[model samples]
Target: MPKPTVKVWMEEGVHSAIFAQQAVVGVFKLPQVTCLCCAIGLPPVHPNVHSTQKGRLLMSSITSTQVVSLSSQAPRPLPFWRRWLRKIEWRLLLLPVIGLLLWQGWVLLAESGYYADFIVPHPDTVWARLQERWADGSLVTHIATTLREALSGLFIASLIATALGYIIARVKIFDYLLTPYLIFLQAIPIIAISPLIIIWFGSGLASKVVIAAMITWFPMMIATIVGIRNVSTNLREMMRANAATHWQIFRHLEIPSAMPELLGGLKIAVTLSVVGAAVGEFVSAREGLGYLVMYGRGISDTPTVVLAVLMLTVVSLVLYSLVAMLETSLLSWRKAGKP
Candidate 1:
């Protein structure tokens, strides 16, 4: 009797190379070779593999020992959950962590420095000052005053910017005529003329609104221009074929298409509007969180300063979240349409 043509082997032990032996001999005999491991319930090679009729025949004839031995050497795969966790977005997750660290570090540094004399009352003493202000109803009034200004500025700026952006996006001539001037306006630092804004509008609500609008307008314009122009030419052509009026096309097609970009711009505008409003308040107002911060700084009341900073931060987060929620509600249709 001839020696057996097939042998079997596994990585963990000194077994014969039976699967390879069987594959080679089967192909030599019948001009075909199929995967022995696959025959014994091992995972198949990827779908992109090329095969001929002869290869199929050889694969079909492989011995059980050869098939079983090859199957035992299958590679280990990572557990699904472990792999997913490894890919979790660290950069996004780390942002809040970094902010917390900075907050703590600022408190520590403030407690130790000679400059602390002017920067604030000691971090330890600041909380007591905040408590006193809160007890007297002063903190709440200041917080409410600043919040109203910031939110109003954000809302009005968002509306005006969206409207103006839509017009510029729709009209090439308007875009050309106004875009450069808008860019020039944005290039100037808001802080440099915040005093001038107070001088012009006289430390009142109107000046804050103007500053917020200026800060909010540029992103809205750029986003709208990009969004409207990004509308599908196919959709435009379909509307034209239906003999839709320009206004009808805009109402039915353009605005919906541009909503995601518009909402993104609005989110940025929301945060910046708060900054603009606060800066305006810092320059002149006796009320608002900016005024609170200014007041706390002047007297070296660190705790009160922290409280004002915290209030501003919370307000910005809340406003930004509201815009994001709006985006989610409005864009649900687009998401549902996708595969």
Candidate 2:
């Protein structure tokens, strides 16, 4: 029996064609043969031996009909516009596009004083207040304080949660001991025990950082656990069959396989850290964005309150963006997995 031969073809680095050609003549036969390559699963370029240019070229150019043409002269390397189109197909623009549109709508609505009751004030008024606060340096101080606490909390939470998650996923004893308590913590709202946190740690940076950590920990924990546990069983078996040590299995296979989930958890942690910091400041703090908001609300300065809220939102967005950028950098291997 003659073995099958494959001709792999590419056009501008994109998979263009895969041809299966036979070497022996009438001794062996292939029934219902079909070309296996196309750009993103479209119909094969050469279906019949006489239909398209690809088919005509294949049939007329080859004396034996046993030969197959993988592609047509490397396809001219694709035009610039076509390359751009391919890139567009490769990347996702949906979430950012929707977010920008929503942001624009919010700006327009805020300026129009449409939801001017207790929710949001006019955008111009908010902007004016922002400028005034900026000039006085209080806004900058507030933003800095809040961001410091949020980042501190996020760092602590990510470290602890990721470590614990890896432990619980890999160690049955740790999972038994800690999983239920972690779940309980996740279920409990930080707002419900604000008084306790303030009483224990005081209305200082410590309390704020702790609050942020508490809020951010659960999601990271859950994501890490799922990710670590979700490594393909076949891959695990392969590693074990090769007599790989436990550490080797984890370092080589488990960590990389679970990275997507870990990054996902980190992204959630980033947004939650901002919210936690603000909530802590809102409940009990001398300085920070939440304190500004509390101060504005106390005096019925709706515009100032609106400005603080907007600033907090911008902070969350910035943190989330940073996390997303980090995720992309760390998980370049998952580009095909990304939508």
Top candidate (TM-score) = 2
lDDT of 1 at 187: 95
> Model 1, range 206-313, lDDT digits (tens) per residue?
888778777777887778878898899999999999999999998998989888888888888889988988899889987888988898778866677878887888
Q: TM-scores for all candidates?
A: 0.64, 0.67
Which lDDT values do the candidates have, in the order given? 0.72, 0.76
User: How many residue pairs clash in each candidate at the backbone level?
Assistant: 10, 1
List clashing residue pairs in candidate 2. Answer: 110-123
RMSD after Cα superposition, model 2: 9.9
Worst ten in a row by lDDT for model 2? 24-33
lDDT of 2 at 122: 56
